[model samples]
Target: MDFPCIDRLEMRQRDLMAGPEPTYEKVVTGYELFHDSTPFVCDHGGVLPQMDVAYESWGRLNADRSNAILIHTGLSGSSHARSHAKNSRPGWWEKFIGPGLAIDTDRFFVVCTNVIGGCYGSTGPWSVNPATGQRYATTFPLLTVNDMVRAQFRLLDHLGIHKLHASVGASMGGMQSLCAAALHPERVGRLVTISACARSHPYSIALRFAQRQALMADPNFRRGFYYDGVQPHVGMKLARAVATVTYRSGPEWELRFGRRRRAPDQPPALCPDFLIETYLDHQSERFCLQYDANSLLYVSKAMDMFDISQSVTRRLAAQREHAAADLGHELATTAAACANVSVCMNIEDQPASTTGHSQAETEDEIAQDLIAGVRNAKQPTLVLGVQSDILFPVKQQREIAEILRRAGNERVTYYELDAMYGHDTFLIDVVNVGAAIKGHLENTT
Candidate 1:
């Protein structure tokens, strides 16, 4: 979509184009992600048979199609990843994905899709279920990272893309990248999973559960059936606040909100508060303003179901527990049938498949390996992250680099960016990060 005089307009105009009108406003020279309708599959096991795939692009696709770089964004991110002919605020990751930047359009074909449950143009919980003609709302499918990846695969298929030069993402996006690798290994030439784990960590699940609870607990949350009228802002904001803490680091919080007290001039001994409180307050408010409660539940639940532990776990407790009077009987059972389960690791992620009890390092190591895959791939991978990143810590990025080194994926490299702006850096530091990504893309090919 060509860049409309978008910067001149506020949040109001963006809503109109991506919201109601069915037209493609130009975003750049030749790149555009037209506003199109996609169907949400409800008739088939609550499947989104058709869904909107909003996107923007640059440069041109070579006839060979080998240059396409498929980008999957994190939770709450849209397809606006760069600036167009006339816009200023640029796009989300516009910093790293344009003309002369890392994901240089001149050299690569880039395509970013709004995930299935995303509020963007994608057909999500808020999307109208073609059957009922009402927003799917709570009726939306219980989607997974694999589902999101499947949706993208279909989009690429629709675009006639049989193979990809690389697939990339951070946080939830990173999770999608890994899922793509696992589910459809041959499709990607290179893969990157930055600051993300193979499966949802228990702590992460707890936090998301809390957020969901906050939203559902609200009188507005009417079960998964809130579409009748009442919306759940208070519940969603409370959940956002819970998530916000995890996105940032404790030390960062100390620096951001630790010094100042609200009652003016209170000393440190007063357990003083700082400006960060106000910052989180405003962020939580704004987040709730744009996102829907049901969307939060769907995405967060998807993350919860991810079993990054899948690829590494070679044995299933159900299979192990079955009284195999005859070994031949095992083939008929399923993994989820087990009562108490423990994953058996392989030599790749662990020294041995020892499973007397769950080892913290075992879990952390598996997650670390996934993150490392992004930084050190035998193929090309671009990693962009914040220095004081409270969300996906710089330490995590460093760990990613180390893991890449260990994995022998030396081709992988990282861009440790400066976004003092904290966890929202990916969303806020678009200009600089976009440039960094663009440069990386240019250097790779």
Candidate 2:
């Protein structure tokens, strides 16, 4: 299908800044790290000579430096989680994070950093490769949730933050929070994960594969080396269109635009005909304007490849029994199904193994580690799930809470929000989302 040309696309930033609501007065200072002497190592054994990570912070670091919160972004989010003194464009989580809001910047120091493999200021496919003098493009090594967490840890160390009072994230960000809590149990005191899972389900992986295929289908993509020429805007638009559908619930679409034609009196044309089609088109266009095509490819793949169980298993081998009886059995069955697909489809480049272990063994170990982490986690954790969410179903959230409870962690709590917004409920349903987070923080304190 023909899509809008990248050159003709008008870039219009969303008007999220204008509001009467109170915002943080502290200057949102921007910071960059990992660009000089430190080289970042990827989970796939690849190394970047130097990497750049862009981040923003608000509020004041107390004398004891204990009132700090780290906010991780989703697949398309940046470091700008909320409005600040400088740029006022409201961030992705502006409603849930402000001076007197859910995060309460007035009393806590909040930091949000763009994930490494993102289109935002952080280093990714668009960044120039120090070795080749050109964009890394497809040459950028594959990344995982753990790799992103490790990068965030460097930022925390740079800021002299030894421990976080709380770590919060939704969607892809939730995966990062899970990784942080599991990998560095002592660094994070409280954890909140919304609409996230321990690992990508096969259905989610299939959806991601379709998006990647859409991008690669464009001849102008040139295998992600389209820096000097026309971009694959059509592919990117199509990919976003697919993702937008998964982000919302079917009930939402039916209630918002039920078979309503864009033009009531006119006949259907080659372009969008229904109101839903128009909505998807608008979302796709907006995404294409703001995000990098290659970055989307990388970030989505990272989400699909994320398996917190693997990271936990690789770290604490002694806690295998906790996982073996519960999560391990389920994970092994899923891995077997995935293996069957891989063999039948002849797709050999599986990104499951973080270490040198075989895929089957690694999957088994991950399940054990996940259970162990939940059992061993001393910090209070809150897992929030949206009832209508299909991408990361409520079942996933329940599984997280159940595993934690099974591991004998009494501090774990799970809440399911009743919202038609589906996976996007955490962003759109601020009242309930904010209340849950604030209540958890208060209880922990």
User: Considering every candidate listed, which one attains the maximal lDDT?
Assistant: 2
Candidate 1 ranges beyond 4 A from true positions: 1-45, 85-89, 262-274, 309-378, 381-445
- Model 1 residue 287 lDDT score: 72
RMSD list, candidates in order: 11.1, 10.1
Candidates in order, TM-scores: namely: 0.68, 0.83
Worst 10 residues of 1 by lDDT: 338-347
Clashing pairs in 2: none
lDDT of 2 at 421: 98
Provide backbone clash counts, one per model.
Answer: 41, 0
